[model samples]
Target: MDDSRAKGPPADADINLTEPAPVEASLTDNPQKLKIAYEQTILYARDLNLKIGELKQAEKALRQNAADLAVLFEASQVFLSQNNIETTLQTACQLIVSRFDLQLSWVGVLTNDENEIHPAAVYPPHDHSDSHPLNQVGASSAAGQELIRQAIHTTQAVASRYSEPEARQAQPAALTDDAYSLAALPLLHNGEVLGVMSVYSRQPDYFTPDRLQILQSFANLTAVALVKARLFERLQLLSQQLVDAQEAERRHIARELHDEIGQTLTAVKINLQAMQRRSGVSDLTASLQESMDIVEQAIQQVRNLSLDLRPSLLDDLGLVATLRWYLDRQARWAGLSTQLTVTPSNLQLPANLETVCFRLVQEALTNALRHAQAQTIQVDLQQHDKELQLVIGDDGLGFEVEPTLKRVAYGKGLGLVGMQERVSLLGGRFELESAPGQGTQIRVFLPVPPALAEDRSA
Candidate 1:
């Protein structure tokens, strides 16, 4: 009997016995099935584990990207806000130190000679010993110098795991014994290299290609910032130079008028007096008197011209006395009612500050006399803390303060421009307020020098 028939299934009668029995296989005959199942299970588990690892890696990359983006955004904002090289570099250094886990980072700006680079920013790693020779890299080292030069010339990023021969020769003790990696990136703007950014690591292969690329991008951004800061500095220098030249010219003109025209007027007055003394006849008396009157008028004109060029009172006396003299003259000439108020009567200011204040007052009075058709003017000077303030107001039929009015009215009026320039040169604040049917008010605020303030107090 067949072994299957011998073991007949009679316990479960519901099952048909003679159904040509489905193809049957024993565990012993196909023992490889167990091994195959085990292999498939291992592969499936491995694939799942790999997928999980990939997801984690992707998440980590995403977070890093976000962090980098945030840093770039902050850097951009800071770059735009600052207007000078020192502040910009300081901000950049702080940001990099705060954001990156860097061993060493620094910015090297090309010097005027273009052969040397100056350290603008430097961040030393925590583990770096203060006595290490690398500490002097920024000051004097072939490696640092060559890195800067290469970055500037190539306008591209460079990295080196091994110390260059020249650098080792220049600072053998520093590089020969130390195994530090370096990266140098060109800071470029508008296809021009402005500077170099360098980073150092005590460990070999500390930076990857991707990290170098990121640094290069940061360098590009920094380049724009540096360019903007440099441009701003240049503009400021040019403006200051122009102001200095203009002031020098004005002083020269003022001196010329006082020495030349003033002396001639004095001589004319002397001659007229002599002629009047010699002529005693009544017929000639009238002519001589007329001549005397003309000479007196000429003398007055000459004095006025001299005063306009540079007030003698300003140089001889202080701002308050000079302003008093100016107001008296203006009141007499314009025939306008004038009021003067001065607080802290013993107020004295720096020479430059005094000059600015006097000029502002003079310009305001001139504007009122020439254009303001006002009958009454008030001039006030006050001191508070470290500040000196001057306010000149007039009860004039004021014009609109709109741009159109400013362009038309102030175009012909150099008084406003002159006053503004004086105040600006003194590092003061100036404001003009006026509207149609409203009176004009000119206010100036100047910071008093400590020495002058002490002198006034004394």
Candidate 2:
């Protein structure tokens, strides 16, 4: 029984005592494996850090993109809802600066000559001084000038660094210390450049390709919005002008009726009553003659009024006859010499086109008489295949063409805008040529509808 506890297990007990523990066995027996495992763990931690950094960058980019999208979406809605171009553009500039953390923002329109960029909308509005500091910076600096030229000439989005020391010196005091990068996106429609949207950013390489694309689209949307707003305003003005023209026509008709017809009828009635009171055959005859004279005068007055309202010849004969009648009448009334020439004497035109042509000549003659103080005016109408061409020229005091066009655009240039609108609505072309002291010339070309052309040929 004592053998179970001692003598048989002596060697086994000695072996167990000499053997290492599990934790120590791993470290001491396989040092290379331990080092490899440690290296692997370290590498895994380093990889995890790198992945985390990449994830953070991705998140940041996502957030920026989201913010950009939000700003653009809101801007679209703002532009859509806004009816005034100035308000729309100003609000857009303000939004861009605030949302994108930009230093400044502006929208510039190319002048008619395309030689200058006039600031249309600006954030942190320029001072009341005659000179716009930022605008001067844009015009004066080489980089700034190139940026504008590139965008306008190429009709694309252009970007340039605006960190030149000289350019910075040209900046206003508020923006002198800060660096800037400028991006110009051309406002384009149907391959024509309307203007440029200039944005300034603090960060370098801020406008990525994606960002630029978004901005270009925004610029395009803005261009369309501006054009729509302009058209809307023009329509409103036209509506008001139409109302005014109707009122004026009504007044004129009323005056003519009162002055000519009413007076003649009153005189005739008085004479007839006098004749009724006196019983002489000669008196009756005299009264009858007087009444007939008055009647003839009244007839002439009515005829004039009718012609003024809408010439019967326009509906009966055509545009050419109406033009001749109106020009003769106006020339006689104004004591101005006038000449009208129509090629292919028997040429025909659409009814509406004829009316338009007549009104255009009438307005032109009126302007020449009233404003131009012209001695002579000439009108020429020609049909060239599928197009009708008209030229109205006057030897009179002229005006600055560009300024006059501006006035017309704003609804001010004595019926010139109306003429342009009429031509444009008919898918026609209108052009004006004038200078100080030189005579004014208006040229219009209207395309003939296929049906009308066919009718003429037939």
Candidate 3:
């Protein structure tokens, strides 16, 4: 009933209705207080600016760390993916040159003499002309110029600014600009310097401590890979030597048995035959004939054993005749049809080549007989101007090729590995093709001089 009066009446007794109340004391009005307020505002603004700057710095650091991790990841992938030293260095250098702010990258292996760092792989920069070139600098020099040499000698990472005279002298040429730095890390494994990895960048002081640590890790991984490759190569060499020694021993034994036992048997048979012809008593003649027959059989057995050890035909008649003889024998024994085609019919190969070809064919045939359950096989051999090629094929149930490779790598398929090593030792190529149900084929190419065939034929 009186809502307006009730809302207005209780507050009216001693109050001014219209005039604004006296302004309260505040920093907004007083000079000093206002100045203080302005100063505080400025201080807060400055603090905000500083905080933003710090946040930006943190963001940049995070980005840099991410890039470093990515680079390390790629280096690790390189170590995992590549088994060859040349390919590994090439790929790893390329990755670094592409991903990082780098001008050039190179990898050099320490020679056994420890005198030189031979450049194994190099990744040139965007402007190839301005790129820092790799120099084969001596490790022990008075100049102290070679970062790579220093790193290797100390088995540590070394860094230098491109502007330094000694560092500049160590580089291939003057940089297009002075804004560059260099770092060299020793590739060390088990306390030995395997090689050196050098990187060039377009920023001064590019090799920070954090980056140096990552690079050192990369170098270590590279060294481990190099060691593994070296061990494999050494193992292959030892295997080849063992195979050679075995062959030599076989040849020696075969020669001794043929020369000593074969001749004696032949002489004994001739004497017995003469005795049989001259004997007066029937019983004595019969006994002499029987002895002659026994000696002849023994001689035949000795000849067979000698041939098996190392065929005289392989030495005398050469690979062609021996292969023909062997193929004929295999056809009879294994009951498999074989077709062999050797171009020019009068090809003569080096002893190693002949032995490798013969062994390859022999092993192929043996595998077919023992495992393939195949009926027919084909072999093609050709001599080219710069290479010799061999192709062998079979019509049998095939198998997965990858698992076989893994097995060979782990030393299980020695026959296959032996064949491969023989070809590789001669700088040849060997390849196999197969599948679950189709068939199997082997192809080989051996780099050879054209004159090799002609010289042997002559």
Candidate 4:
């Protein structure tokens, strides 16, 4: 080898600059370096375990949140659809207990006269049995009662444990010894505390802040349902008053047409006949006879007008008689077959119910002739137990019932809508069934109040 070549640096033996560095520790021969790397590895494992634990906790929380939202959504749907107050509150109490898995739940209404709560509904309804301690929820634990009062007074949600000092101070007597914890949320609407919804839990520390928030949402929905129910009740009263006033006006007009115009026309015809008899001249007698004919026609028209407005028979003879007469006459005029069936042959109803039944039939029959184009019509009136039912069926050209009724608001289906409003005002049910090429049938059910039913049976 040349002396100059030996002076050059030797080439590397085991190195690849193109490859990436190894991430795994080599634990080099140096003792200090190995010790430092080992300690760092232990710390990294500890932090990894901590991160895994937090992820599990986050997943559990998300599941609980999802369940709570589902319950709230379902409750909102039910509350909006219900129009009865008692049913709405009862359902709310039932849902809270069943979904949350609690010991007891109840709703109490604070009446205007009483300072304390009056129990309205309870979950695990009282069976009047001694088997279950939770049955007597109306007389709840001391803590539960106190929580309700606090919620009402403060207009806020309250919670307490029976073993707590405050709970013991509320009442020394353990009325709710079975419940370990209690919570109450106020039912508030329009600045008014309507009631309180209370819950009892057998587990300690069960009612957390998140759970209270969910319960408050339920209370808010319940308040909305209460407002809707009261408004519906008021609307019903106003509707009935309107119907009564309209009927009164019709009665007045009918009387004027029949009593005043009818009598005067009859008197004129009588006088004209007398004149014809007294006058012997042919020219004058012929003229008097023609005048008598005109007066008779006028009298007949006046009588028809009075009957159409508000039939006197509806007042004097009752519903059945008026129905029979109207159906018979209308059938003859329209050249169609008609039938009216009265159950028990002596069925009678309250005056308002009677009016509703007759008008319903009248309007239905008119629609059948104008829209259905049917040749035959049938009306059935039956009193079954505490309910009075009327069914009007016709074999005519039929149309979609729902679409036509929906048009009522726009004034196109006033005749059908009028019948529905009349029934609704009385807290009754109305059902209309019709399809193209199918006959139309209208069914109405009016409840006979307990007082009237008793009188009827007697």
Could you tell which candidate, 2 or 3, scores higher by lDDT? 3
Candidate 3 residue-wise lDDT, 132-212, digit = tens: 354322222222247876897799998866565555555445554544677888888899898888887767788898888
Which should have the higher lDDT, number 3 or number 4? Answer: 4
> Each prediction's Cα RMSD?
12.1, 22.6, 11.7, 10.1
In candidate 2, the residue pairs with backbone N, CA or C atoms under 3 Å apart (3 or more residues apart, or in different chains) clash, namely none
lDDT of 4 at 177: 46
Best by lDDT: 4
| TM values, all candidates | 0.60, 0.49, 0.72, 0.82
Instruction: Report the Cα lDDT for residue 223, model 4.
Output: 79
TM-score, candidate number 3? 0.72
- Flag regions of model 4 displaced more than 4 Å: 1-25, 28-42, 112-119, 127-142, 164-179, 280-287, 409-411, 451-458
lDDT of 1 by residue, 1-458 (tens): 23544343444243332222222355336767655444445544555555677679899989988888888888898899887787787676566656766555778788888776777876653235544444545324566667767767777787766545534543335445445566788888788777787776655576688777777877888888888988877876777678667656766777777788767867887886787788888778788778768877876776667678777677788888888888887889879888889888877676667767776777777777777788899989998777888999998888777662467455645667667766765657888899877989988888888876666666
Per-residue lDDT of 134 in model 1: 47
Candidate 3's C-alpha runs over 4 A off are: 1-95, 99-101, 106-132, 135-144, 163-175, 278-297, 332-335, 343-348, 384-387, 397-413, 427-429, 435-437, 449-458
Evaluation by lDDT, superior candidate among 1 and 4: 4
Model 1 TM-score is 0.60
Error of 1 at 307 (Å): 0.3
Angstrom error of the Cα, residue 96, model 2: value is 2.3
TM-score, predicted candidate 4 vs. hidden true structure: 0.82
Per-residue lDDT tens digits of candidate 2, residues 241-300? 674576467546756676677677767767666665664687677767677677767767
